[model samples]
Target: MPDNERRTDQRLERAILELLDRRAASATICPSDAARAAYEGDDDGWRALMEPARRAARRLAAAGEVEITQAGRPIESAEARGPIRIRRTR
Candidate 1:
Protein backbone atom coordinates (compact mmCIF):
# COMPACT_ATOMS: atom_id res chain seq x y z
CA MET A 1 0.00 0.00 0.00
CA PRO A 2 1.05 3.57 -0.62
CA ASP A 3 1.95 5.87 2.23
CA ASN A 4 -1.38 7.65 1.82
CA GLU A 5 -3.32 4.41 2.17
CA ARG A 6 -1.37 3.51 5.29
CA ARG A 7 -2.04 6.94 6.71
CA THR A 8 -5.74 6.64 6.03
CA ASP A 9 -5.90 3.37 7.94
CA GLN A 10 -4.17 4.95 10.90
CA ARG A 11 -6.44 7.95 10.70
CA LEU A 12 -9.50 5.78 10.43
CA GLU A 13 -8.53 3.88 13.54
CA ARG A 14 -8.11 7.03 15.58
CA ALA A 15 -11.20 8.61 14.08
CA ILE A 16 -13.23 5.57 15.07
CA LEU A 17 -12.31 5.97 18.72
CA GLU A 18 -12.62 9.73 18.65
CA LEU A 19 -16.04 9.61 17.05
CA LEU A 20 -17.22 7.05 19.57
CA ASP A 21 -16.01 9.26 22.38
CA ARG A 22 -18.46 11.94 21.32
CA ARG A 23 -21.48 9.69 21.43
CA ALA A 24 -23.50 8.62 24.46
CA ALA A 25 -22.16 5.55 26.21
CA SER A 26 -25.20 3.65 25.07
CA ALA A 27 -25.08 5.03 21.56
CA THR A 28 -23.22 3.66 18.57
CA ILE A 29 -21.68 4.95 15.34
CA CYS A 30 -21.46 3.56 11.87
CA PRO A 31 -18.15 2.98 10.13
CA SER A 32 -19.02 5.71 7.65
CA ASP A 33 -18.75 8.22 10.47
CA ALA A 34 -15.06 7.44 10.77
CA ALA A 35 -14.60 7.33 7.02
CA ARG A 36 -16.20 10.75 6.61
CA ALA A 37 -14.21 12.16 9.49
CA ALA A 38 -10.98 10.97 7.83
CA TYR A 39 -12.11 11.90 4.34
CA GLU A 40 -11.11 15.17 2.72
CA GLY A 41 -13.74 15.41 0.00
CA ASP A 42 -17.05 17.24 -0.05
CA ASP A 43 -18.61 14.66 -2.35
CA ASP A 44 -19.42 10.99 -1.79
CA GLY A 45 -15.78 10.10 -2.28
CA TRP A 46 -15.64 8.76 1.24
CA ARG A 47 -17.74 5.88 -0.03
CA ALA A 48 -14.58 4.35 -1.38
CA LEU A 49 -13.23 4.08 2.15
CA MET A 50 -16.14 1.93 3.30
CA GLU A 51 -14.28 -1.36 3.46
CA PRO A 52 -11.23 0.24 4.98
CA ALA A 53 -13.42 1.75 7.64
CA ARG A 54 -14.94 -1.65 8.37
CA ARG A 55 -11.48 -3.15 8.59
CA ALA A 56 -10.52 -0.48 11.09
CA ALA A 57 -13.51 -1.33 13.23
CA ARG A 58 -12.63 -5.00 13.03
CA ARG A 59 -9.12 -4.27 14.20
CA LEU A 60 -10.41 -2.20 17.06
CA ALA A 61 -12.85 -4.94 18.00
CA ALA A 62 -10.06 -7.49 18.00
CA ALA A 63 -8.17 -5.28 20.42
CA GLY A 64 -11.21 -5.30 22.73
CA GLU A 65 -11.57 -1.55 22.52
CA VAL A 66 -14.87 -1.60 20.68
CA GLU A 67 -17.89 -3.78 20.13
CA ILE A 68 -19.24 -4.56 16.68
CA THR A 69 -22.98 -5.03 16.67
CA GLN A 70 -25.66 -6.04 14.25
CA ALA A 71 -29.32 -5.41 15.11
CA GLY A 72 -28.20 -4.34 18.55
CA ARG A 73 -26.45 -7.59 19.41
CA PRO A 74 -22.71 -7.98 19.63
CA ILE A 75 -21.22 -10.27 16.99
CA GLU A 76 -17.83 -11.37 15.72
CA SER A 77 -16.39 -8.91 13.27
CA ALA A 78 -15.79 -11.59 10.66
CA GLU A 79 -19.48 -12.52 10.82
CA ALA A 80 -20.62 -8.92 10.58
CA ARG A 81 -22.25 -8.14 7.25
CA GLY A 82 -24.58 -5.47 5.94
CA PRO A 83 -25.27 -2.57 8.30
CA ILE A 84 -23.42 -2.53 11.61
CA ARG A 85 -22.85 -0.20 14.52
CA ILE A 86 -19.84 0.35 16.77
CA ARG A 87 -19.71 1.25 20.42
CA ARG A 88 -16.85 1.39 22.85
CA THR A 89 -16.43 -1.74 24.93
CA ARG A 90 -17.52 -1.39 28.50
Candidate 2:
Protein backbone atom coordinates (compact mmCIF):
# COMPACT_ATOMS: atom_id res chain seq x y z
CA MET A 1 0.00 0.00 0.00
CA PRO A 2 1.02 3.55 -0.55
CA ASP A 3 2.21 5.76 2.28
CA ASN A 4 -0.82 8.00 2.12
CA GLU A 5 -3.22 5.09 2.29
CA ARG A 6 -1.34 3.67 5.23
CA ARG A 7 -1.55 6.99 7.02
CA THR A 8 -5.26 7.22 6.37
CA ASP A 9 -5.75 3.69 7.64
CA GLN A 10 -3.89 4.54 10.80
CA ARG A 11 -6.00 7.63 11.30
CA LEU A 12 -9.20 5.63 10.84
CA GLU A 13 -8.08 3.05 13.38
CA ARG A 14 -7.17 5.71 15.88
CA ALA A 15 -10.43 7.50 15.33
CA ILE A 16 -12.35 4.27 15.83
CA LEU A 17 -10.64 3.55 19.13
CA GLU A 18 -11.07 7.11 20.33
CA LEU A 19 -14.74 7.22 19.45
CA LEU A 20 -15.32 3.93 21.22
CA ASP A 21 -13.51 5.18 24.30
CA ARG A 22 -15.78 8.17 24.59
CA ARG A 23 -18.88 6.01 24.76
CA ALA A 24 -20.02 3.77 27.57
CA ALA A 25 -18.33 0.40 27.82
CA SER A 26 -21.54 -1.11 26.48
CA ALA A 27 -22.08 1.59 23.92
CA THR A 28 -21.09 1.26 20.27
CA ILE A 29 -20.31 3.45 17.31
CA CYS A 30 -20.97 2.97 13.62
CA PRO A 31 -18.06 2.75 11.21
CA SER A 32 -19.34 5.93 9.61
CA ASP A 33 -18.65 7.70 12.87
CA ALA A 34 -15.00 6.87 12.62
CA ALA A 35 -14.97 7.81 8.96
CA ARG A 36 -16.51 11.14 9.75
CA ALA A 37 -14.06 11.75 12.56
CA ALA A 38 -11.16 11.03 10.27
CA TYR A 39 -12.52 13.16 7.48
CA GLU A 40 -11.89 16.90 7.52
CA GLY A 41 -14.75 17.97 5.33
CA ASP A 42 -18.20 19.42 5.66
CA ASP A 43 -19.12 17.75 2.41
CA ASP A 44 -19.31 14.05 1.42
CA GLY A 45 -15.60 13.36 1.65
CA TRP A 46 -16.18 10.96 4.49
CA ARG A 47 -18.02 8.65 2.11
CA ALA A 48 -14.72 7.67 0.58
CA LEU A 49 -13.49 6.34 3.94
CA MET A 50 -16.45 4.13 4.77
CA GLU A 51 -14.87 0.92 3.49
CA PRO A 52 -11.60 1.79 5.10
CA ALA A 53 -13.40 2.38 8.38
CA ARG A 54 -14.98 -1.09 8.19
CA ARG A 55 -11.63 -2.65 7.46
CA ALA A 56 -10.16 -0.69 10.34
CA ALA A 57 -12.82 -2.08 12.64
CA ARG A 58 -12.06 -5.57 11.43
CA ARG A 59 -8.41 -5.08 12.14
CA LEU A 60 -9.21 -3.85 15.65
CA ALA A 61 -11.50 -6.82 16.16
CA ALA A 62 -8.69 -9.17 15.21
CA ALA A 63 -6.54 -7.48 17.82
CA GLY A 64 -9.19 -8.09 20.48
CA GLU A 65 -9.53 -4.38 20.98
CA VAL A 66 -13.05 -4.02 19.62
CA GLU A 67 -16.11 -6.01 18.63
CA ILE A 68 -18.13 -5.89 15.44
CA THR A 69 -21.81 -5.84 16.17
CA GLN A 70 -24.98 -6.11 14.13
CA ALA A 71 -28.44 -5.85 15.61
CA GLY A 72 -26.81 -5.25 18.99
CA ARG A 73 -25.10 -8.64 18.97
CA PRO A 74 -21.53 -9.49 18.30
CA ILE A 75 -20.90 -11.09 14.90
CA GLU A 76 -17.97 -12.56 13.08
CA SER A 77 -16.20 -10.07 10.89
CA ALA A 78 -16.77 -12.22 7.83
CA GLU A 79 -20.47 -12.46 8.60
CA ALA A 80 -20.77 -8.77 9.40
CA ARG A 81 -22.57 -7.29 6.45
CA GLY A 82 -24.88 -4.31 6.05
CA PRO A 83 -25.08 -2.07 9.11
CA ILE A 84 -22.63 -2.71 11.94
CA ARG A 85 -21.31 -0.97 15.03
CA ILE A 86 -18.03 -0.98 16.92
CA ARG A 87 -17.65 -1.30 20.66
CA ARG A 88 -14.68 -1.94 22.86
CA THR A 89 -14.06 -5.63 23.37
CA ARG A 90 -15.28 -7.01 26.64
Candidate 3:
Protein backbone atom coordinates (compact mmCIF):
# COMPACT_ATOMS: atom_id res chain seq x y z
CA MET A 1 0.00 0.00 0.00
CA PRO A 2 0.99 3.63 -0.42
CA ASP A 3 2.58 5.36 2.54
CA ASN A 4 -0.36 7.66 3.19
CA GLU A 5 -2.88 4.84 3.00
CA ARG A 6 -0.77 2.74 5.32
CA ARG A 7 -0.65 5.57 7.84
CA THR A 8 -4.42 5.97 7.67
CA ASP A 9 -4.84 2.24 8.24
CA GLN A 10 -2.59 2.40 11.28
CA ARG A 11 -4.52 5.36 12.61
CA LEU A 12 -7.82 3.56 12.22
CA GLU A 13 -6.44 0.49 13.99
CA ARG A 14 -5.27 2.63 16.89
CA ALA A 15 -8.62 4.38 16.99
CA ILE A 16 -10.42 1.05 17.19
CA LEU A 17 -8.25 -0.18 20.05
CA GLU A 18 -8.39 3.11 21.91
CA LEU A 19 -12.15 3.42 21.55
CA LEU A 20 -12.59 -0.08 22.92
CA ASP A 21 -10.28 0.69 25.82
CA ARG A 22 -12.52 3.57 26.88
CA ARG A 23 -15.67 1.48 26.96
CA ALA A 24 -16.86 -1.25 29.31
CA ALA A 25 -15.12 -4.56 28.71
CA SER A 26 -18.31 -5.99 27.32
CA ALA A 27 -19.09 -2.96 25.18
CA THR A 28 -18.86 -2.94 21.42
CA ILE A 29 -18.38 -0.18 18.83
CA CYS A 30 -19.31 0.42 15.24
CA PRO A 31 -16.55 0.82 12.71
CA SER A 32 -17.75 4.38 12.14
CA ASP A 33 -16.67 5.27 15.64
CA ALA A 34 -13.07 4.56 14.72
CA ALA A 35 -13.48 6.31 11.39
CA ARG A 36 -14.81 9.37 13.15
CA ALA A 37 -12.08 9.30 15.76
CA ALA A 38 -9.36 9.00 13.12
CA TYR A 39 -10.85 11.59 10.85
CA GLU A 40 -10.13 15.31 11.08
CA GLY A 41 -12.09 18.48 10.19
CA ASP A 42 -15.45 17.10 11.35
CA ASP A 43 -17.03 16.45 7.96
CA ASP A 44 -18.76 13.59 6.18
CA GLY A 45 -15.36 12.72 4.75
CA TRP A 46 -15.15 10.25 7.57
CA ARG A 47 -17.72 8.23 5.73
CA ALA A 48 -15.07 7.42 3.17
CA LEU A 49 -13.07 5.73 5.88
CA MET A 50 -15.76 3.20 6.64
CA GLU A 51 -14.26 0.38 4.59
CA PRO A 52 -10.80 1.15 5.88
CA ALA A 53 -12.10 1.09 9.39
CA ARG A 54 -13.61 -2.32 8.79
CA ARG A 55 -10.35 -3.51 7.33
CA ALA A 56 -8.54 -2.26 10.41
CA ALA A 57 -10.95 -4.18 12.58
CA ARG A 58 -10.29 -7.30 10.57
CA ARG A 59 -6.56 -6.82 10.89
CA LEU A 60 -6.89 -6.39 14.62
CA ALA A 61 -9.05 -9.48 14.79
CA ALA A 62 -6.49 -11.47 12.86
CA ALA A 63 -3.88 -10.25 15.32
CA GLY A 64 -5.99 -11.48 18.24
CA GLU A 65 -6.35 -7.96 19.58
CA VAL A 66 -10.09 -7.70 18.97
CA GLU A 67 -13.21 -9.58 17.99
CA ILE A 68 -15.67 -8.89 15.18
CA THR A 69 -19.28 -9.79 15.66
CA GLN A 70 -22.63 -9.64 13.93
CA ALA A 71 -25.91 -10.07 15.74
CA GLY A 72 -24.02 -10.46 18.99
CA ARG A 73 -22.11 -13.53 17.83
CA PRO A 74 -18.44 -13.57 17.01
CA ILE A 75 -17.66 -14.31 13.38
CA GLU A 76 -14.58 -14.73 11.27
CA SER A 77 -13.55 -11.40 9.86
CA ALA A 78 -13.35 -12.80 6.34
CA GLU A 79 -16.94 -13.98 6.64
CA ALA A 80 -18.30 -10.75 8.09
CA ARG A 81 -20.88 -8.89 6.05
CA GLY A 82 -23.42 -6.11 6.61
CA PRO A 83 -23.45 -4.46 10.04
CA ILE A 84 -20.83 -5.61 12.54
CA ARG A 85 -19.41 -4.57 15.89
CA ILE A 86 -15.87 -4.52 17.34
CA ARG A 87 -14.94 -5.33 20.87
CA ARG A 88 -11.86 -6.34 22.78
CA THR A 89 -11.19 -10.05 22.65
CA ARG A 90 -12.51 -11.95 25.66
Q: Going through the candidates in order, what is the number of backbone clashes in each? A: 0, 0, 0
lDDT of 3 by residue, 1-90 (tens): 899999999999999999999999999999999999999767799999999999999999999999999999999998997999999999
Off by over 4 Å in 2: none
Report model 2's TM-score to 2 decimal places.
Answer: 0.97
* lDDT value, residue 47 of candidate 2: 97
As a whole number from 0 to 100, the lDDT of residue 57 in candidate 2 is 97
Task: Look at candidate 1 and give me any clashing residue pairs.
Answer: none
**Candidate 2 C-alpha lDDT tens digits along 1-90:** 999999999999999999988888999999999999999889999999999999999999999999999999999999987999999998
Worst 10 residues of 3 by lDDT: 39-48
| TM-score-superior candidate, 1 or 3 | 3
Number of backbone clashes in candidate 2: 0
Compose the digit string of candidate 1's lDDT tens values, residues 1-90: 999989999999999999988989888999999999999889999999999999999999999999999999999998987999999997
RMSD of 1: 0.9
TM-score of candidate 1 relative to the true fold: 0.94
Which residues of candidate 3, in runs, are more than 4 Å off? none
